[model samples]
Target: GGISRAGRDALGEATAKILASANTYENQTIFLTGSKAYTLKEITSFISKILGRDIPLRFVSLEEYINQYLNCLDEYWVRLWARTYLALKREELARVYPTLENLLGRKPKSLEQTIKEIFTDKQTGEKESKLTNKYWQASTFDNK
Candidate 1:
């Protein structure tokens, strides 16, 4: 999976609810999660459908990942990410929790909605947004 994956908007709302009821939710630990956990393959497939462009993917081993990123990222970050990916592969953060929806009293923004927010203007439905362009530019893909 790409991440334990909760939309930022949904997470923010959940945080607000917890803060608002500080007395009730005091000293509590909640694992906020998306409606579902999406794998990287699924996310890229959705992105390709929306953007009408192929986004290539290449899998790498833990050592490969660390070496590939070490130049651009510090050793600390590279090692941290390596560990995180290992945990992800083990499905440590794969569980989806309803605590967010329960607190919000409505369905939280989904991963697809978050993708739309990043790539398109919701109100106008115009061309791809600047953020989308930046995303493409910043992204490093293995086309192999």
Candidate 2:
């Protein structure tokens, strides 16, 4: 079974609605989530499709990112945090919840639609405008 990933804005909207009917869900723990689950790879693929370009994915160790960006931190803590991040990434994050839909009284946005709302440029169909130019300007590996 896959877990659903809710868009942040969608989740917020659902939360507001749920709160408005506090009497109904009072004293109960409600699970709020997107209507569907998606893996990181799936999300990346969707972004690529919307951009109409292949986005290169490069896997780098957490240590590398930390070393490059947070070198001021203590070595031991950095390694510890990186290990924790790696472990979390390896786990399943997809969560499906009916509570959100029930609370909203309407179907929540699908993962694709949610992603498009977040990443797509409505006017030009380009991914973050800056990235579009960079993506197009980069030479393909075949060219090099």
Candidate 3:
């Protein structure tokens, strides 16, 4: 308990120091990504406030086949994330899509749907390689 808090405080101080130094540098780019959308936004805003410039922090969903499959097996995790996607509790379907819910209807039901939702360019649109396909493709963080 104490150790975790200590590590957290140390991290906060280190982050502050980095922010201060980065402002002095004035041209370095910072990327933020995580499951905590709010935390990522906060960190990105903090850096922007320090730098007095707009930082391009993009959000990408974290989608992984093995991870999604494992999570689907966990009933509780499935319910929570499906609700996040507003999914209709389909045990038959392995993964859920928030984008599809946002579509209201006519949801795309394949790798094609997911890709169309991501890339806006109709001409150059293509599915991600099996190795790289995941829920979110924001420029902030890479999956393990």
Candidate 4:
């Protein structure tokens, strides 16, 4: 349920081209996005791989996630967002858009590759941040 490699490449190329020819599309609103879409579960799996750890996942209704986890007034927006996300059909998200591919004359990268690129540093080959490591270490799951 994620973008293909061709889609990623197409998106990058399209961005570069748009920037180069800014004068042509200066006032126009362009809807540029990944040709393919991925579900939250797929995205989390990619993140787990990038972090080199197993990330436990559980599916729950919007009411469950909100009632069990969200407790503060400040977190109301998160509950709203989750409700909105859960409302969409999986089929709707799985549909691919060819606009990006047509514009760039190529396909985009796979979801896995894109996640790796985003999480790994280009020069050092290390993860972009140690936050995941810290969180895992500090979490009480192991103790349980």
Candidate 5:
């Protein structure tokens, strides 16, 4: 898939900055994104280099994808996501916009930076959530 990936920290910062600047950016819609678009292979290559281990890539047909996940997911889910897979295959979800960088006053986090933030020492200057502590609990796909 040719879709974009943005770091959560950058997205959060951008959102905060935009909200604080509501008067300056009022009534304007924006599309935020990472600086560049990457293919799955390029993304995995970043992961491989960072983790110092090979992240395997398996190219499969849409049918194969549906069949593989159909057991864990429902028939409706598997069937519905066939459209998403097709869109990804068609490069329909990929776009990079400068709004995020502009708002953050610097480049959005690189893939490596985001990965390191997640996998390395989790130290960052990001603020603690103003929301309830329960918001800190992250959910995975299975959990969600």
Candidate 6:
């Protein structure tokens, strides 16, 4: 399929942003996925031009992302549904907490680090009781 001019422009801009952000961070890994349409070479060319360095970037299709990251779920519909559900729950938590200070402990410097810790704890089968709906209210006192 032929790429639209507008699409190319958008991709170029996204590539530039990615490269700039990646260069700013030390030892950064960027993941890009959008079905099976995007081109790695085009993105790399733009990134290389912006960063002034030849850095290897990883590219994976949406199918590959779901297959590898979301193992237990086979159907795409199911995976998307579960993703939506989790997103809503996270939003609900954010609404109540409003800030990282409202969380059970001190906030990590990096959100990525916090997510990694959460995933590790889950993988190790650490016991964590799910938050109750009643606790969704914003409280004046830190009730941990």
Best model per lDDT:
1
TM-score winner between candidates 5 and 6: 5
C-alpha root-mean-square deviation, each candidate: 4.0, 6.9, 19.7, 6.8, 8.6, 21.6
lDDT per residue as tens, model 3, 22-140:
76537854321111122334544544443345556553334532254454387567435534322212222232323222322332233323223333334544433232433432233
Q: Global lDDT for candidate 4?
A: 0.60
Tell me the TM-score of each prediction against the true structure: 0.80, 0.67, 0.21, 0.59, 0.70, 0.21
Q: Evaluate all candidate structures by whole-model CA lDDT and list the values in order.
A: 0.72, 0.65, 0.35, 0.60, 0.68, 0.35
lDDT value for model 6: 0.35
Residue 120 accuracy (lDDT) in model 4? 85
lDDT of 4 by residue, 1-144 (tens): 332233445566888888998998899876655656766567778878788787666655556655655676447676665544443433434556676666776655667687788778788888845345454321111111
- Relative to the true structure, candidate 2 reaches a TM of 0.67
Residue-level lDDT of model 2, residues 1-144, one tens digit each, is 233677787689988987888898899988888877765557677778877777665556554556644558788776665554354364444546688888778888888887787676778766766443554321111111
Scored by lDDT, model 1 comes in at 0.72
Error of 6 at 41 (Å): 0.7
Off by over 4 Å in 5: 23-27, 74-83, 121-144
lDDT of each residue in 23-45, candidate 6, tens digit only: 56458543322212223344444
User: Residue 40 lDDT in model 2?
Assistant: 52
Q: Candidate 1, 57: how far from true, in Å?
A: 1.7
Model 5 gets an lDDT of 0.68
Cα lDDT tens digits for candidate 5, 1-144: 566778988899999988887898888788888888777677667656655666677666666666877789898977786676566666666777889989888998787677656645445433322233232221112100
lDDT minimum window of 10 residues, candidate 6: 135-144
Worst 10 residues of 4 by lDDT: 135-144
Q: Give candidate 5's total backbone clashes.
A: 0
Error of 4 at 16 (Å): 7.7
